[model samples]
Target: MQDKTNNQESSLTRRDFIKTAAIGAGAAAIVSMSLTEGQSQTQPAEAPKTQPSATPLKLEDVLKKAREKLYPRCRVCPECDGRACSGEVPGMGGIGSGKSFHNNYDSLAKIQLKMKTFHDVKKPDTSITLWGHKLAVPILSAATGGVTYNMGLKGKMTDEEYIDALLGGCIKAGTIGMAADGIGDPLDIYEIRLKAVAKYNGKAIATIKPKTQEEIIKRIRMIEKAGGLAFAVDIDSAGRAARALPGQTVEPKTMKQLKELAQCTKLPFIIKGIMTVEEAEMAVECGAAGIVVSNHGGRVLDHTPGSADVLAPIADKVKGKIVIFVDGGIRYGADVLKMLALGADAVLVGRPLLRGAVGGGQDGVALLINKMKNELVDSMVLTGTADVKKVKRDILIV
Candidate 1:
């Protein structure tokens, strides 16, 4: 058998040789003096000839490094004045037309600028006290259904494991986990999350689908008994079936019905998918504790304004009367800051969590959240804000 270590050493270039030598020397010294067995073993046997100095890395640094490694230069085509044009290169494949706001780097740059300003502004207290539980951050894992179906990783994530991971990650991140109804039987999902919450000491927000007032009431009672912190109904999806999955129906709940449901649950009642001020006021009239200004991630309605677009108006209308949350196309910590600046109490993430789940299971999910949180803190520090609550609207241009 060939010696793998010898082969590795032989394959090292001159630069690698110098780097390894320096690293090895430093590692050997540290190992020799260190008492910890694990720490000592991590050091290389040979002294390194050229190694970089040991610099402590903050979470923000790690995330920045990761971002640089993961997302390269902006490859998407620049959108010209109102024309939908597709630009394709030989090796890069086809990139979508820049006509969509999401596809435009300039729009993203503006959002980033606003985010930085918000971060520089006084940091708002990110701590939130809702449903009798105090959370470290206002962000929540929005109730997103069909994740397993969409990702085609059903067998990879067991029901218990998935629930446990979601609950655990949420707790670790100091946020609440919101689970959508109709992913499975309501009672079964409730029970699974109940166990996860108890075990992880986490909070859960169960979103019941639109149903008859009586059924809604029953589900609310069940959620309360199951020890959930909040109850919600995704009103935007009501009376509609997902185009991705035609079998899944989202029956819309009326204001009267929502009011009755709110009255039934002792837990905080949140109404998801309020796109307009009219709907937001109705949610308040229906006695909602919070309103999530969402557009179902553009999965429900095409060509609708992004959630960020409507957040300010809705926040202005509701003022201080209700807790405001928003979700849609939030992929970074700066995005979270932008939403908060726009009057969102916090922002919810959906697809990112799913991506994390697919890529790394529970630990991957944790990594994804930790990365986001670190980015958020970095944004805060760079903008001169000390905490989450101090983030304000004046920090934004639009």
Candidate 2:
């Protein structure tokens, strides 16, 4: 039998069932809805509002608004795992097959939390200090941009507006955000994001693509002038060199080039795409102050392991040698605890935070972070974990 809600449309697609599966069996009532071009861009469609409870219902409102704002480009699905929009690169899904993206979600989900209630662990400390800035939570916004083509929000939202929402929201939440470097962006577009970073002087991170050494150094100088607390080079973007527009080039960096980039800046230099123990070791050898275990959210690769799948081994090899951070499929505070127990100094959240920004602006972003902060505190209390900075490995049944 056909579903009545999808009046004029056919039965639900694989993506729709995937969404239901991720949320729960009951989420079938909230099947994905397709919007016309006119409605997709202009009107805000009503989505299912989450049931009110002790947990804040604000995120559902934010997701509903974001779904309207980012329709077609992103369904803002019940689950943000790559399943619903797998293999969509220009838009929001991962690269070919999206196996890498799926890995991120599966790897984290496979680890079971060992809950303990027989302890006096009240008021867990969810704070951590990164480069002298004390954060209310161990979360930061990963560098993300390309709002126009990537998010289909060109006319609806400008690049500056998006960056402001991200950086400003992170600051409001007592954490930090990273401004991205779009492969096809013009010099002016890049400068505008830097200005946003400068707006939060010494509180934000600026990320550059894996362009040439000269080009990388040039942007580092600009980041320094912007008073950025740190700068990162997403070496994983090297895979998209062919997609780069003329005059904007990307390439893999050699150890010599990496060292030069690290020494050229007074700010902390982070290498943002280390996925292996060998590469993690090389990042330390290159004098990087930090390394983000990522696969560009599985956007740049097809069959790579999830950051969660590889984080512990990499962390075991270089956890204290350099600050270790992980990103990819981190959607909740429980996931944050799992990553910490597996060995991560902190976690970087991408898509959900992006939804918060696109859907609810700065306040939306702050609300999302604050919600996760509360969840993190609760998770810590139940697991006998006392602090974000000192999470133990025994808290998980991996």
Candidate 3:
């Protein structure tokens, strides 16, 4: 809830935050040069360090578009940082109490990096392979839908157009995209998304609600026919029973059902919306290919800890065996680095990208991803991290 105050402290922009960090890094480099001035002649000469005012990233321009397109409708606040939009899940805010929303941001902020001045820091390798295809960054778009109902962007664009823009952006950026389905959505509307995913040649993923086995399987068959690379079911959607469609219901999967569902697909089976180590273990037992440490962007449950708060423990319980990804309060590239250090193969971003699609369409999404990639590299260089895959616990000041 301190986003306004914190964003003010961010000096009005994300660039300013990176600028300050860069300046501190420059200062550290200068001190290191001073101490090693007369070291062994075999050492390669290094450039002198002086603080350079970092320039604003080109991505900032997209926010200008977002401001015009969003705002009044979504606000597109100075910072996409969670506070302004908590407790409004059905319309872009977190679920009741907003505590879960605040926790994701708070826990990530509490994790400070142990930056080093002397070491072999290479260009950060931000690439990762998800479900067999390589991506430029270890990031994915969180499955989100209902621009009219959820984003309040009525009259701005239709649902089909919105899905196209988001998915197109991700694929163009050399990464995968996620297309979401809602229980209230008509079957035809859901199939429209399936066609879009197929157009991307199976690079896009499909997400289903936790509906009855027959309905869920029917949808899965459709997704596979569409050439989706993988599929997931947001179990958190089960809590929205009041919103269930007539003749349709959503419920949590029993272990038996989960195993059967996993068997239903040759593509990777991902179980999203998991928050407990026990549930995470259950996912493994059910033959899941991945598990997303999410609290449904804090939109499904109230009074729960943020995904970041529980991720470390869940990750400790199941790390290499399952592709672990996390998604709440992930507004920055530094947050991506933090999650990877804590134990995540990748991270997903939600609201900001929605704004990106709303404002600049595919271009905006690519710009946002490129910006996060740059910021991740910057943070890695400052911390002397050479590789993302081998990120160590020592990097955390803890």
Candidate 4:
């Protein structure tokens, strides 16, 4: 492969190399952002355009471009259920059998929506006010990184380019994006990621891996400096310790440590990775302002229950105590409604937006989000739901 580098460069793109490596490694399929608190009274920074073109970009066009760029790194499959790229970790897919990822898709698929058009609900309000920041939609971009290795875009896209498109697109759509800290990322690279968060002027969230208390605190300080609205520790990343790069450490945090981390930041400190009622309650007790019920998109473990399956129970236990955000298999606008009915305050979407960034840049990301929002509107109208903040449980047949 090294000897053919020059020859391949003449005729091949990074996407092609990623496809070649996937075949050599034996893979069937592969696949698959906001704001600050406190301080300033200054006006927010303006968001950059998705592209310079004046012509409106279609969602299908974005997906086509993403499919070309992502190729085997992700098939940009119609379903995106982790089946095609089952064991393609360090690339896309999930860990081990990919059962957890499959469960995420299946669980959401099993949820049936009830269409009630008789009521006089023409326009459904999709806006949400999360922690005093009002948003156009309940959907926010999930924090994702490692574009060079994980997504195989080394030569084609830089981390900065990918994140800029991700955050910029979300901001343009009147929502927020997340900035991620890869387990292998050094402090300098993390600082670079924070710059994207800063560029949005406190309209993005920064997610940290479950490193030591000191490390988490240090990064929190940095995020505060960047005008980040909130920060989260993906405690599920603790399971990836064996896979972590040398000199990097990730460990599960005790309640005591979590409290310290929460108190360390004036910004709303979120604890991501809660999958059960017990832990959800614990998060509330630990002073977490918010909790993201995730399983790291099913990437850290195998055979786990889907986020949707586990969400309702957790929400039942601690719904009003902490802000709830769930991510896993949320594809369309109705999926967003189902989650709201399941008791989530809002939802986070992954994978699809990544495809947008890879295939069409900022505009692609915004188009995809707006498409979901429109779908959400249709869903609300069909279900006689007037507001996103108060979706009824009867809207879903479960």
Q: Count the backbone clashes (under 3 Å) in each candidate.
A: 21, 0, 2, 15
lDDT of 3: 0.77
- For 275-377, candidate 3 gives per-residue lDDT tens digits of 9999999999999999999988878888888787888889999998899989988878888898998899989898888877776677567667766777888
Q: Evaluate residue 10 in candidate 1 and report its C-alpha lDDT on the 0 to 100 scale.
A: 89
Q: Distance from true position, residue 140, model 4, in Å?
A: 0.4
Which 10 successive residues of model 4 have the least lDDT summed?
A: 34-43
Would you list the C-alpha lDDT of every candidate in the order shown? 0.58, 0.83, 0.77, 0.83
Please give the distance, in angstroms, between residue 208's alpha carbon in candidate 4 and its true position after superposition.
0.4
Worst 10 residues of 3 by lDDT: 29-38
Given candidate 2, what's the lDDT at residue 82? Answer: 91
Stretches > 4 Å off in candidate 2: 1-11, 14-57
Clashing pairs in 2: none
TM-score of model 1 (CA atoms): 0.69
Candidate 2 similarity to native, TM-score: 0.87
Regions of candidate 3 where Cα sits further than 4 Å from its true position: 1-58
Model 3 earns a TM-score of 0.84
lDDT of 1 at 230: 80
After TM-score superposition, the amount by which residue 313's alpha carbon in candidate 2 deviates from its true location, in angstroms, is 0.7
Estimate the TM-score of every prediction. Answer: 0.69, 0.87, 0.84, 0.87
lDDT tens digits by residue: candidate 2, 1-398: 46575553346676664444334422323223222212211111211222334333255667766776777778787777898778888888899999998999889999999999999999787778888877878889988888998999978999999999999878767788989998888878989999998888758889998887888888998988999999999999998787777787898888998999888877889999999999999999999999999998999989999889899999899988888889999988899999999899988999989998987777677777777777788899999999888899999998
